[model samples]
Target: MRRNPERRAALVDAAIEVLARDGARGLTFRAVDAEAGVPAGTASNYFAKRDELFTQAGGRIYERLQPDATTLAGTREGPRDAARVTELLREIVGRISAFRTGYLALLELRLEATRRPELRDVLTERVRADVEANVAHHLESGLPGDATSVRLLYLALNWLIVERLTLPGVFSEEDVRRLVADAVERVLPAVTRPDGPGPS
Candidate 1:
């Protein structure tokens, strides 16, 4: 096994692209080597097995999807109201949707996880922790919505993303914006809940 961090990272990224473009079936060590433009056998030196590659790719996708300081700052400065929540959700949706290959590769990894309990456990734990963190953030940030509101948006918005990615023609960009607004309106209170952070 190799201990080259940069090389391993590049291999993982290459794996993600291969998964997105060709799915799990097409994700061979040779395929990754080819995608990375590295010599044949290079990916094998970095990844001991395909499952290792899968888990690394999943973690990398999350890394690539994370928001930066500006995006994080936007969350705190916004008004603590449903509309603000909608805007935040819209921004989040946009950010996640923008990483087309990452999301698509995630879908591929998820399918692979079904047959491999080891991969399933790793992915489930990571995703579940993420969901819990979102719920906790909603509650602590004084966001207008409750934990339930956050969960609802999580469910609806993710499906909307799937639709947008898998079938772009199904809804126009304007339609997505409207649907996001409507989801927030339906799930969150018209006025900020008394228990939540007061509107700025």
Candidate 2:
């Protein structure tokens, strides 16, 4: 296998696009090569097996989807209340929806995982770690939610993302945003105020 990190990353990204468009059955070395506009067999050189490519693509998609430092820092700047949580959920939807191909490809990886135990294990671990990280973040940031609330939000918001990416017409953009706020309200305790700015 080749040792060029950039080339390997490019191949994995191309594989993500192919998986999103064609699913696991259609992801071939030649297909990835064409998608990447590299020489034939280039992907095969980097990934010895199709399963290896699938695993790399799965991780690569999440890497591309993760928020940058600015986005993370912004989450901590505002009030730590239910409304702030709602805005965070909205940001989650918007961020994931913006990377349509990556999210769609992730869905494909989930389906493929059903038949491939190796792939399933990797995905399971990565997703579990992600959930734990969210829980930690919620707790540390003084967000108006417990661990369960964060987990519930994670579940609801992910399905919302799926609907937005796969069947966008089902919900208008405004409706999706509303649903995010609704989901937050459902899982989080109401943070009511006396109709004025919070006291010092």
Q: Which prediction has the highest lDDT against the true structure? A: 1
Deviation of model 2 at 84, angstroms: 0.7
lDDT by candidate, in order shown = 0.87, 0.87
Under the 3 Å rule for N, CA and C atoms, how many clashes does model 2 have? 0
Model 2 per-residue lDDT tens digits across residues 57-142: 88888789889999998989888778888888898889988999899989999999999999998889889988999899888888
TM-score computed on alpha carbons, candidate 2: 0.94
How many pairs of residues collide in model 1?
0
Pairs with backbone N, CA or C atoms under 3 Å apart (clashes), candidate 1: none
The estimated TM-scores of all candidates read 0.93, 0.94
